[model samples]
Target: MVSKPALRTGGYIFKFFFRETKMNISISKKGISALLASVLLTLAAPVTTLANVKNPGLLVHAADDEATTLDPAQVEPGEGGETIILQVYDRLLDIDPYSPNLVPSLATEVPTIANGGISSNGLTYTFKLRQGVSFHDGTAFTADDVKFSWDRAMEMDLPEGNAGALSDVVASTEVVDDFTFKVTLSEPVADFLNSVVVAMVSSVVSQDAVEANGGVEAGSPNEFMAGNMVGTGPYKFLVWNRNENIQLEVNDNYWGENAKLNVRVEIGGDPDVRVLGLRAGEFDTVETDPSFVADLEGADGVTIYTGGLLLEPLHIGFNLNIPEGSLPDGDTIPEDFFHDPRIRQAFNHAFDYEAFLNGPLAGYGAFNPHYTPIGIFGHDESAPVYAKQNYAEAERLFKEAGVWDEGFSVSVITEEGNLFALMCLVLKDSIEKLNPKFRINVLAVAEAVFDDAHAQNPLEYAMWAKNADPAADPNFYMQAYQHPDGEWGEVHGFANGYKDAGKVAELIDAAAVELDTGKRAALYKELNEILYNDPMWLIGAQEGVVMAHRDWLKGFVQNPLWPRPSLKFALFDK
Candidate 1:
């Protein structure tokens, strides 16, 4: 059996400690005796240092990943970039770190139809901006800045950026007054506030700062903004030592509750190193794994923090149209490899779901249906799913697909030395056991290379492994993963593979604009059933979050809805 490593549950382990020593030595005839006496005293007990060297409230965090860019519009959602963005920038609206409820941030209140903040038709939204708020640059926050920031993000719709969150619904953003902002959507979108407004991509940036730096350009990332940050949150950007650590200091000038502790986020990619640091009191917290729970649960001064299962679940995406000349084994596999529904179903049944849930996930996960996981709006516990592997079903499907005797070879890609690669190895082991003719190659590549290839039109690989970005609403999931014209759908050519692509697209579009909660949910539930029959991706288990932190670190709330390392530093105190 191929050994699989634990999931790199990206985390921010804040290790806080400071030591300083001061010694007074007499330069008399007894200099050697005095120095020896002072050294003995220091060894016996603690020595007091100067007031200037006294330790302030500070935390040093280590993580498995680093921020690719600080630009809110450019950063990939749910990545390391978000942890920094939420600390440094404030959105018009915010989600409570402990709950899914929306909270007022830059805006005076969350816009709703009941308060006339949202239009009856739901296309228009008006926000009453907070007064006396200022960006890190000391510029007044106003409706004009709000409009400029939103407009700039929409205009600079870089292909790699998360601008689609805004560009997809917003038709225009208008400033009614210095403190009033209005947004008109092209269509009435259900859960628009939770999914898009509260998202990091919709975060308001300093208009003056951005204009002075690299101005907004369509389809191009602002290099200046990517490296620097200026916002109206509880923390200010102190310094970002690339590939080393990022430091943030408490913003004394913040309009809201001030942050209790200054944060220093270090980039530590190796989980073993992070674990060692946590055990040695070198890290207050670390990006923890389920496997590490056994190691750290009994360690002194450590607390294991576990929260609800994350909405994000890893999936094995099947590409219907593998590009010509890109197949790993062209002689054995065809370009239209996963175009057959039976083949997709066969692969789905071939995976050992229970093993994965208990193995790498440590039984803290659930087998969710495609595109819907626990805590997501559309997720239903009653939904049918592939709960376990059935070799009989796998063999029967292969025979039905007429590939029992002529088994094919194909390569599936994943990031090297990660849980996704391990999942691929699991799939490889199970599928190969069916027949000697069946062959599978797990192609592990660097993350950058994998991402670059994953982003290609009509994905080059026959299959690839990765997780979905967490979303509060079903519309975002349907559009990105289920809709025929959506990101993965268009790229993987699900329109060609799906039996009724037009019908699926229709239902997804209807769900997005559906105002009635019952109707919207019903639409998604229907899609879930339809998709289960015509599977486009293999649903991996959804893992809950578990972090190990120093017992002294209080008020650590892990909200799966927030970005990875799920704690909000402002709410924490040591």
Candidate 2:
């Protein structure tokens, strides 16, 4: 059975107030909203002072409520888990908020070819750990912990975990001393530091704590560490009330900048409820949808901050290897339907990209055809743009593929949500309109079922999103999508049976080890052209991240690499 924190009456009452008054609050008296009035009363109320004395902290309401796990190595990329993991774990190298370069975190400095810490051949890297640092459990951190953490991550071999980024790169780890270690790579990986070592998956864990809980042999979904945490970060885990909230307290012995406020992360999935909580002073900050910005604009004491385009781009992936008889509605799709480049190209041109972006996306997204965000390296601005709807060209390609005569019916699956489900509907409407014979079925499934379907078969089509780390090279995204035996292709079941899979894998391998930046960029550009012409997936819009916070919440910096803002330096002015 999972252990839960003692339910505080004050916390319960505060949550009740937000849940009850959220939708009904009106602005009538002197143009001051009931929510604003409630805020004023709550600030002045004596009960507020007593409540603060009991629990002096900041409450952050997340738009995403579910967290699969908190164990860094086991965590998939998500808003809730990533937000908490950032607070509980420290990486070897930290992403600088203001720049694209990497900075030191657990390590004293970043290793580079220019620095002697990295060998001349670029196959070996030596890291000097920061001395006097300790985990939240009060155990002193050492190089052994570093080696154990990374080795354990690779040994576990989680297909979905971010640690897969280092699968073939890290040959072995050697602990030199109490505060020093060296990582030997199988090949010269130019972006190994940014892509793998600096990734959150490489976060060091307490070897002793892990052993006591369950070592690598304990298997995945590391239940013990998922609910608990022991790391050398700025905050310590207090309690995780699953699907409800996660409470964290400041680590008094933190080696870096200490967190000013104990945090209470209330898990509310509805954006409107989160907005209401922010207005009623129930939360210090809240992650909100871009659609909610118009409603919250000009509200008192609330500032809407927009984090420009996220690293993730919304796209539609084709299941090239769907079994012939596996589709819904008893329809039998040809085995080679998605594998045919003509069909993929035709599907790409069938969507009305601009209409969907301006309408459902609230005019807050831009077209990116390379399956990569605009700001990242190797984006290939010269690649053929596919932003406009082209039904005539689509018809021609369909005819060439010999699927236009009878037309074909296929079910496209998307997770049940306002954005993704709406995207599926739009595609269905647009594709059906192109030809009456063209049948498109949009299936919106629950999050859990949808995740399983996506991982297992993906049926005929799947609409998904991917976030590539901006600080890392574009090879990270390419390896996942273009390479046949790569993480996403082989593990997550996407583009697994493409004819050029082997060739794409070879190109990706070549690009990974290329030391010259220009040569690497050219190789990626060539790969982008191949994928663009063949069209593995239909690239969609780059969505923006919009958030709202109270004016008193300070020092919140948005990093593209993370789904949520970095709260390490954040403080509650109140």
Candidate 3:
């Protein structure tokens, strides 16, 4: 259903508001949200006419599919990182969500080797840029478009490529003049400015929209950037249809301030058709699910908010090598009888996870033991708890780790929630009460077979599931879940393979080049004691930053990263 013409989207249909108004600073996604109450009554004017006007507010975000492209180097972050980082590309460095540090857009600051910032031999880094920052196809934003968007996803290799994160301490980028540039590093890379504000390595691209859209390739520029978008930030890209809706307007020559609001986006295939188009008003703000959080908990024109959700680690990934690890082309992994760590410590003490977080989240939810999620660094809200019925210490840790081969059993893939189908029926009734020769097999697959069995890394399931949130960086758990051939936390880090000694990938490179906040929190508390004693992964709860608006959707903030339902200091209460 590629759809999108069923206009009057929320119904009672006001028959066209008379189209044609998307020019001098485009408007009308709902007619610039009814001019957002006269730009919040001219918000005390004069920052150059609020930097050219276009804020007031109306944000809508909800994804079930269809944002696979919006040009952050031809988007495909597997699927929606909040519709390509808050309404398509802007990074000249971001991430300040109240103190994770590094701000400034299209750069004026943020780029220095502690001042002199050298590498004449320390490997190199120069930078200067940020002059008259242009490019919504107006060209001019140089240092050779930040050395062609930092080596354009490895000269067009992109699959959201960070050019293999600039292979072994970069070795190129020399512009050094028109606003300077250098970068050379083959060594000293400790947070080389958070590995160069990655949006596909320092996103700035526009070598004439990369040769009008295909000379600096990597795939998915959404057929030449959907509606011709180019960015210096503060909104500009106005239309997309590929799965059902996307709109961003308000670049009013933006250098800053003029960001009141006018960013609409959707991927709605169905979540009851996005809460019936946000309860029939169409949508002014969105981020629904968790079984529509008990149908909007309080209702009456919705508002619901919830924490900031530290980035995403909703968790479950197993492929240590087949019966959980040691794959050979995948699926049907139940052998050597799960090579016994007493059957992965009897399915990790047969997950009761506090009676599945006190049955259906009435208790709301809690239990994460760090595979890294709750605001990063091995979060361990006191680790040990998973006994809905600990089958006598999971049959004494499955006959003391002999992997109780009572005809061997292991198969747990899930995805339809009562919090993961009640932990896949509490690991199939506590791993069949730890013996009946222990047999457990629960399947569930829906939502494109849970996204095509985790993008086809399936080996007949011994373990598989989804959840995420840790990419604000600390090599986001070694470049997405222990870089096991990582391409950005592919449904639970490292679909297992890419140098597996995973000693938290060398303490995620000493907490990503050690900027030293108590030695990067003591090298992330020694990589959370080798990620909770190498459980490889299993963080279950601690994600609350939810949102559901309508009480006139007042001044929003939300962003814990990704289009977390963009509000960026949102407003519209009048």
Index of the highest-TM-score prediction = 1
lDDT of model 1 at position 197: 89
Q: State the displacement of the C-alpha of residue 381, model 2, in Å, after optimal TM-score superposition.
A: 2.5
TM-score of 3: 0.33
Query: Which sequence of candidate numbers ranks them by TM-score, best first?
Result: 1, 2, 3
- Winner of 1 and 2 under TM-score: 1
Stretches of candidate 2 exceeding 4 Å from the true structure: 1-59, 158-160, 212-222, 330-333, 457-471, 488-502, 563-574
lDDT of 3 by residue, 420-528 (tens): 6545664565556546765656666565676676666434454665666335555655566655445433433333433234555566765666654677766666665
Q: For residues 413-443, what per-residue lDDT tens digits would candidate 2 score against the true structure?
A: 8776556665666677778888898887777
Q: Please tell me which model should have the higher TM-score, number 1 or number 3.
A: 1
List clash counts for every candidate, in order. Answer: 5, 0, 26
Candidate 1, which segments miss by more than 4 Å at Cα?
A: 1-56
Candidate 1: global Cα-lDDT? 0.79
Which residue window of length 10 is worst by lDDT in model 2? 10-19
TM-score of each: 0.88, 0.85, 0.33
The candidate that achieves the highest lDDT relative to the unseen native structure = 1
TM-score of 1: 0.88
